[model samples]
Target: MLYPIFEYFDQVLDIPGTGVFRYISFRAGMAALVSLIITITFGKNIINWIRNKQIGETVRDLGLEGQNEKKGTPTMGGLMIMAGIIIPTLLFANINNIYIILLLITTVWLGGIGFLDDYIKVFRKNKEGLAGRFKIIGQIVIGIVVGATLYFHEGVVVREFTNPVSIEQGMVETPAFKDVKTMKTTIPFMKDNELNYEKIFGFLGDSATPIFYILIVIFIVTAVSNGANITDGIDGLAAGTSAIIGLTIAIFAYISGNAIFSQYLNVFFIPNSGELVIFCAAFVGACVGFLWYNSYPAQVFMGDTGSLMLGGVIAVLSFALRKELLIPVLCGIFVIENASVIIQVSYFKYTKKKYGEGRRVFLMSPLHHHYQKKNIHEAKIVTRFWILGILLAIITLATLKLR
Candidate 1:
């Protein structure tokens, strides 16, 4: 909102300082600083409120050391993270931009789902809080909305280019306007890196292209969001890992959005995507600040309030930037956590069919608890996971050049 005011002041009133807001980096930095301030300041007040209302996390005897001791620590501090991200974005970003609008919507929409689940568990005393079906429904609804808009929205498009082995080629420049195309996204470890979903139904010609392409995006959105949600089982694990992933994505978004950088790299140059940097900056700030209270011996649990939104935001941002394929690598932690659950359950069902009881796979699912059960300190586990997240982030960045 303040963007326009800064523009007016800079251009019309000739205010010297207002022009700095024009730079994406400047706005991104401002957003991060603002998010940090909001989290650190309001975090304490919310903690007190949660404690006053006895809105503490109910811990079953998880059998881990210091597990039950955290039974009454505050919960739902994700509200602080939400506020931190939203307010900064509104203040520092171009609110009219479609990407920003979609991000804000996803942030609030999935966040509301998580907050409701947390509320049900805390207030209604329902251990099952918002049935799994409902959560799936909410995620699917979001996926559909995001998928439809991304496919149908005219403002959303990518400017692709070609490379040459024999000679340097000029960018397709006819109308001085770049190619605004809606199709499949990029795939890693490939030569050309392009993978259009429309190709799935080439037999039907142009008619089936839109049908299959939209479904592909919807599937990707749902899968990534749920993957991140389930990965939130341990304190500071998801947040810490998400921060690292967000930083890498933020770098990719920066280069992808900048016309010159994208051309130099011979990659898709998405106009208006630079604005995403500010949103990601806010994301990193919110996650880091939440980590202050979310660290081992956590003062508060983010619950579904933080987890679902975090995952959704990551998914949407990756999709928006055509980096969804990088999720398995960038979000390796979430991917492993997700796969562990799938494997554990699938094996249990298989074993139960053959034997009398369901058997176990790692001490527990979600992967983190497996180590937690082996007397691994929560802090140590979280730290190592963060290291792995960093490792994955670096590997993901290398993909931009490796191919």
Candidate 2:
């Protein structure tokens, strides 16, 4: 909203400072700053409201130190995060841009699902929250919506380098490129990094390829969203880790949207994706600001509300920038958290079936509680996990040049 107003001031009235909004960097900075301000300024009130409404978390006896203390902390603080992100985005981004529109939709859609889950847990007194199948169904529905929009929307397209220019061949100029709709995505650490979904279905006709692509989309969305949801078991774990991931993806979005950067990096150029930088900026700011209250000895918990939206935003942002394939590295914390649960459950079930007694894997699941079982301080565990997330984020960025 503010973007168009500034544009009119700059273009029509020839205002001096309003022209700065034309720069994505400037707008992104504003978005980040605004989002941070919103989160920090309004966060306490939101938490107080949750507390006043008796919307506190129902903590289970996990046997970890300090676990019981968090029993009645106000929950569903994710509303603050959503407000921070959405307000800044609406002010700084081009609302008509398809990518921006999709991201906003992803935020609201998954946020609504998570809010519902949190609602069920707090208001209805259902510790189980929303049914697992229903949660999955919600994710799948959004996945289909996102996948179908990207596949069929005319605005969603990529520019491929058609003519190659090699320095060794004495060609001083860069290659020419053309815009075309494609199902291709960037693969890490590969010579020709682009992989098209159509080629994966070479045996089938072109009509069948989109079906496979949509299925892949659904799988990724569901997996990453759930991974984030599970990772929220500890304070500051999900928000801090997701902030790092969001920053890394924002870099990818900037490069993919810039034609010069895309050519130099030998990556696919996606037009209008620069707008995503603003969204990602808001995302990073929201997460970091939320960390103020969400950190160790937390005043509030984001519950499933924040976790689901965080993962969903990252998934959709990556898909828009063609960096979905890098999610394993970028979201390594969530991936390992998710894998730990899967492995622990599978092994326990197998052992119970074979020996008629359940065998444990880690002292607890989700990876973080394992450290807690080892008597590690919760704050220390969170810090180490955040450091690891930062390392993974760096490695994810390095893939652009490594290829």
Candidate 3:
């Protein structure tokens, strides 16, 4: 919202400081600062309100150490995160940018779903919260919308480098490039990193290619979203992990949006995607600031509201940068958390059917809980996972040169 007014002041009125707003770096920094200020300043008040209103998390005894201490803690603190992110983005970002528009929509859509789930659990007194099927349906719907919009949006175009002046010098001086819309994504550790989705479904003809691509988009969105939700079991785990992931992607978004950097790095130049840097900045700031209260011996929990939106934002941001294929490596922690749960469930059912007794794997699921079951301190487990997340983020960023 503030972008246009500042732009007008800079361009028409020749305002000196207003010109700084045109820089993505400046705007991104401002967004992060604003997000941090909002989160830290108002977060305590929000927690107090939630507590006074009796909106607390209902903890179940799973026999893990320090498990029962979390009961009755003020929950649904994701509202603070949402406010921090949205308010700053609106003030600092280009609201008309297609990528920004999509991100805003994704935030509100998934946040609403999460808020409803938390409301059901806290207000309606339903431990089950929103039905599992309903959450999946909501995620699927948003995935379809994102995929379809990216596919058809006129603003979404990539500048492909047809000739390189010098691969060693990292230059793409040749003008043999064209900005076009294509269904391609960056694949990690490949000499020619671009993977076109059309080639995967060539046998299905042009008409079916888009459909297949959309289906793939839906699957990725749902998987990453749920992975983040599952990873939120411990304090500071999800928020801290997500902040790392967000910072890495913010770098990718900045480079992808910059023509010079994109050409010099031999990466696809996604026109106008640089605006996402503002959104990503706000995201990282929100997560990190929320950690003030969300850490060990938590003052508040983000509940489904924060987890779902965090995952969805990561998914959409990656998709916008055409780096969706790198999600497995970048989100390794979330992937393992999600896989552990799935494996535990499948194995228990199989064992019950085959041997008439349910067998267990890892004492508990989600991997982090397994450590907790082994008498590991919750704070120690969370810190270790965060270190792992940082390592994964470094590996993800290294892919740019690794190829």
lDDT of each: 0.85, 0.91, 0.92
TM-score ranking, high to low: 3, 2, 1
The predicted structure with the larger lDDT, 1 or 3, is 3
Candidate 2 stretches with Cα past 4 Å from truth are 161-177
Model 1 lDDT-worst window of ten = 159-168
As for lDDT, the candidate ahead, 1 or 2, is 2
Score candidate 3 by lDDT: 0.92
Tens digits of lDDT, candidate 2, 1-403? 9989999999999989999999999999999999999989989988888999999999999899998889899999999899989999999999999999999999999999999999999999999999999999999999999999998999999977777634656546666878898888999999989898878895799678878777888999999999999999888999999999999988999998887788788888898999999999999999999999999889999988899999988999888888889989999998999999999999999999999999989999989999999999989999999999999999998998997
The positional error of residue 198 in candidate 1, measured at the CA in angstroms, is 2.1
Instruction: Judge candidate 1 against the unseen true structure and give its global Cα lDDT, from 0 to 1.
Output: 0.85
Least well predicted 10-residue stretch by lDDT in candidate 3: 165-174
How do the predictions measure up, each by TM-score?
0.94, 0.96, 0.96
Model 1 lDDT at residue 134: 91
- For candidate 1, the per-residue lDDT at 124 reads 100
Residue 400, candidate 2: C-alpha displacement in angstroms: 1.0
